[model samples]
Target: MNYRNLFYALALAITANLGVMAQGHKGPAWLSNAVFYQIYPSSYMDTDGNGIGDLPGITSKLDYIKSIGVNTIWLNPVFESGWFDGGYDIIDFYKIDPRFGTNTDMVNLINEAHKRGIKVCLDLVAGHTSDKCQWFKECASGDRNSRYADYFIWSDSISRKDMEQIRQRNSEPNPQASTRGKWVELDAPRGKYYQKNYYVCQPALNYGYANPNPANPWEQSVNAPGPQAVRRELRNIMAFWFDKGVDGFRVDMAASLVKGDPDKKAVMALWQEMRAWINKNYPECVLVSEWSDPKKSIPAGFNIDFEIHLADKIYNTLFFASDDPWGAKGKECYFDKRGLGSLDYFYKKYADIYTSTHDKGYVAFPTANHDFQRLRTGRRYDLQQLKVAMTFFLTMPGVPFIYYGDEIGMKYLPGLQPKEGSRKRSGTRTPMQWSAGETAGFSTCKPENLYFPVDTENGKISVAAEDNDPRSLLNFVRGLIKLRHSSPALNNDGKWQLVSDHSKPYPMVYTRFVDGETYATALNPSGHSVTASLAHLGKAEKMSLTGKVKYKTGNANDKIELGPVSAAVFKIR
Candidate 1:
């Protein structure tokens, strides 16, 4: 047989081994095992003098990310979009946003990430396009008799009189007519018409399937009218990026893709189609759905799991205003949102769990990203208290994501409220403060035009400044992440058992097991000492820690004395 024929034969064999014939359970293997880091490209770093972080900027920081041991990167939208939504509202899927970089820049990023064994996953906005997108404009203009006219959801028309009558019937006792209109006019020049709607800039897409005909209203339904057309457009976009070498996609607002469906079969079909198409062309590529709903199921076409229990876990405790472990009595710390639930409750609530991301409200302790406020700035936890949060998150069974600059204890100034530009770009998106340098070594752009301003006073708080400080929070986080990577029992998929629920307020203890190995982790939630018993477990091995020994196992002092909200990990044989 010729070499060409041999190549075809090998490809078929590889596909068969990957379980392509099995529809329900077969999917990519790397997903469950891989650790991911979310990158806010514009805020991560700047290689050019434009003061905006771009593709090269991310390329330059790969070493820093890799140093933390993550193998996957989930970047927020980098596609062409009006700068207002921070890249979520996409204008064009095929092109890169100018502020981020060019198409070639993205290709280069994929290449670089691949070389380091890291996968690149872009934000795929499958739900809605920015009102500025060309397709929306075409639909408004009635140009070329848009095949996409029904692709977006539109409300039926009713005259001003009918609207007024409906409002009168629904009016409150005060007779306030809040929504006194029926058909709202499209703001565009051609359509020059309106529809009663939601999120003026975002129009919903059609998820039904039928062809448009005056006799059939269902024919005008977005999905009913032309499911293939919409699917083809999205498929083409996915293929475009796949050919450019993106490893996968993290679909945006995925649950909204198919609205008003009881079984969720419409969206599930879309995902299944998208998944099937990608697997055919790029077998290794993964599709991660972002389903914000707590009851989210593994959609028909999804290769990896998505947002579920992890959201409430982090927001309700780590970043919530009620969670401050060290808040002054009668008044909570500015951001403590804990005690609404416990860490064990968060872990036990899910049958399956996903651990990190950039979409969180604040730094997801043990990991932080650029989308929210910096961890140091949002919460006032002392270093010791901070370590407990970190140890708990990093040592948990799934992948751990570390935001840029988090390892070295980056801080945003408190009370630096957000300004008119991109939401609060002022504080969290500031440049990586390497040292007390001019402009924190972030930009040559005049300080005023920068996407964000420097966070430190005289730039004193920086990576270089804290690197040499032995007691620095930066070093503490690094030590924890390094330790997590060192132990398979701590980092791998495991069965976690809650061993103690002592009546104490803060210091907590738990054990995790995987592959015949057991790990015991203890955490202190306050600044003072709190002791807990390790009485039940037999024959203890050595404990892992940095400072002088304040507690030990199996001794006359069998109590674990945690130092002022600190934490420690011990491996018992």
Candidate 2:
């Protein structure tokens, strides 16, 4: 081959070897072993004594977060907001909310985190904004043809036919924003009814519909002047933060953009445009979307799409038996001590996404986020059960997000009165428990002034208490992370295999292998001992074990045993 052609071939080979996107976008190679910690800033740390957590508080905990083995911290929206739907109803993209901290504090936090080899990902509320946003206020008060007028969706009145037509054409399985379909009304001077993305306080920004029905004058095409401008605004917002040294974004309601199109083709195209722009400008910045479907989101150009654990999502099979409070019962989750759960649900979805997107992007998993219950909630709080769950998450493929305070087994405090619209989720978003005290070391302020009351059991599950105990859950998690960082076979793109087992949910066995290196893992969530066959290892000698393994065998008949609610990782020599 000619020199130029040979060079092109070599480049393609190198990209493939590095497990990069086939589309030529250089995804953040750091995400290969990235262990992310999701922080709901308002509840993470309170330094101001005003009971609200701030960017400075986050900066103060950089060492603690780093020591826990998190290389990336995902902070929920820090932008100025109306505070109706948590911090998601963003009013200003460029300025940090006064409740959080100043813009300088954010930059300082980013710099401090990077000094500890940690990347910071801020939540991007891409779809909508606070009704109190200046743009929305102007749009509401101005003429229909005003500059900010087309920034959001506005209509005089919606007939039944129009609502049905719009909903029928917009195709995303279970669309969140459109399901409500409740538009707010205003006086005669302003538009009669305005469209909303979520709560009443938030209005959906106009990205325009992918396919506009000619009969519906309200429906705007994606190429319309307003949409194109909104797209530019989105780009500008990203540029503002990227300039400030922010790492990337976990885009909220990513798939909810670009309405009125079946098959989500137009929304996908919109993100593709974004991907091209970001690739050209900030190639190293990662974009992890809350699309929850990696098969489409990865191909659509996001670096990683979270495989969220929701009722309908694939992750509920494991770690969440029910969504209710402590000891609630329903379908037994894969992490339950009863071992009544099935892996078929999680495995099928996981395998399909992994098979299609492994080389292109990744499917990220979260222990828990601000929206739902935690790993220590319900009847699953036992340290052994948690260790097994952590082992499965840390060693498994894709990025793993440890929601703030999940490392030390923070409880999902139930029945705390709702605030900032957390509702039943208020318990899950409680302050991080650091140590025993009146405020549980979360803040020096009075207990009544806390963002949400610290858990009553904080004395038992606090981080400081666990950090000093060698056998505690905190130490177990640290060990798992250290091993994950040290093992190539357990890295993001390692070839994975499921060891055969007849025990069903008793013992979950899988192996990670690459470049002649291999590591086998077994998780027994059951209440009794279970054995898994390691015959597939092919004369490979057992090297070392990470977690507690009750029994292991080495003869030609290879078998490893697991204790109740325990996990073991075996390094294959």
Candidate 3:
């Protein structure tokens, strides 16, 4: 064959190989061993003298994030929104929040992240928009002719009185912004009308669901809901940004999109349609549903659903609920007292089990999120306890998500609360304390100008001080993430079995096996030291605080002693 023909043949072979890699059989090449770090822009760092975390702040920290072996970045929404809403109540779908950075800054972030072979997934809040969003503003203006009227779910009166009946019967809060019931109160009559069924500021979208009909007017008419018109508008919003080159999206409140119908086919269809659109254009795009319910399938058309509940089950059970004085009460059984879960269970249930998602929240074990409390301030983060928690979350399966300054153990201060109250609720959301420095490096602005104050004691603790301290949690996280990346069994699908048969209080142990290879991991959750057997292994390479340890011909009687909150992984041969 001629040289050109030979070259073409080689190109075809390479394409085929890459296609196989993308099939996710051996797992997607991007994710097989990827570790993701979640950056909350508001608290990550302050550049430009603003206390709020910004793109430049993030850009400055890229090297630090990468140093720990993280290969992916899942940013919490940086989109334009009212400041206090945690970026989830987006005002504009396409614009980055000014407080965070400019669109150019985001593009720069994507560029830098890509240079290191890291994928970037931004959070998408599709369920509702800030009342300030243009769509909501137009719908509120009472202009029936407005193109955006149907973009959100709004009704002058009950289209489905039956649902209203149920709402009253169950004492359930109205799902709509104007509705009067459990949580929302209708705005007082303006002239003659008091609109019911709406959030004061977050108006819900109709999502094309009509009362009992289960079909909206736009979707019911022939030639309506076609890919070209209304749906096109929504698709355009997504495309506008994906074209800017994001790897994927983590769709917010995923289940709420389809909660109106009993069958849920409408919501499923919408997701599938969006997935198809993405496939046709952005083929590498990963769509993650924040639905949390694993039972909710993606119709074989969409790629992934967030495994939130799976992690919830594990995190709540393994350490948080079991260790805290709160024990497990009501929903507390599913979440820690601080509303996060234990580390061990999260690894077992979802780590490798989930094929695609912006690293399950469990792996990262973010103590503070926009919606929840920071662990440091939540009555959870004792210095030793913090060390132990970090040890478990960092080494377990999936990408370790770093929530801003969590590495340095920055925490929320007492008496400080977010839009929602509770120290645990707002702990991690406080400003980053750069040093014992003034205002903790959050903002040069007067403390009153800042959205949240720096925790006087634990707030925005700096990497500067922690970076040099080998014993600091930040250093510990760096070590664990590096260690996890080095392990093929822990990174991928290793057969995992719980070692629950042990006779110990609060210690956790489990073993993972693949082919003849096995990794047995044990955790001592209790305050006291304890010993456990490595009886499951025939032969194993064990890991301890000191160094690589090993065991051979293990039997039912084999065991290892563990320090309080300490963990070990033994590789079986």
lDDT of 3 by residue, 329-410 (tens): 6423222223243444444455444434322212234433454434454345555566556655655544445566666787
Choose the strongest candidate by TM-score.
2
lDDT of 1 at 471: 71
Tens digit of per-residue lDDT, candidate 2, span 381-452 = 777778888888888887888999889888888888877767778888888888898778878899888888
- Candidate 1 per-residue lDDT, tens place, 230-328, comes to 767888888899888898887776755665455665555556556656666777787766664323334345554433223444344434344232222
Weakest lDDT window of 10 consecutive positions for candidate 2: 14-23
TM-score of each: 0.78, 0.90, 0.77
What residue runs in model 1 are displaced by over 4 Å at the alpha carbon?
A: 1-27, 143-145, 156-184, 187-199, 209-225, 262-265, 293-314, 323-366, 369-371, 378-381, 412-421, 424-426, 457-460, 466-474, 502-505, 538-559
| Candidate 3 lDDT for residue 324 | 39
The residue ranges of model 3 lying beyond 4 angstroms of the native Cα positions read 1-28, 141-145, 159-198, 210-230, 297-314, 318-368, 377-379, 419-424, 446-448, 456-461, 502-505, 544-553
Stretches of model 2 off by over 4 angstroms after superposition: 1-26, 161-179, 188-190, 310-312, 323-330, 456-458, 538-557
- All candidates' lDDT scores? 0.59, 0.79, 0.56
Cα deviation of 342, candidate 3, in Å: 11
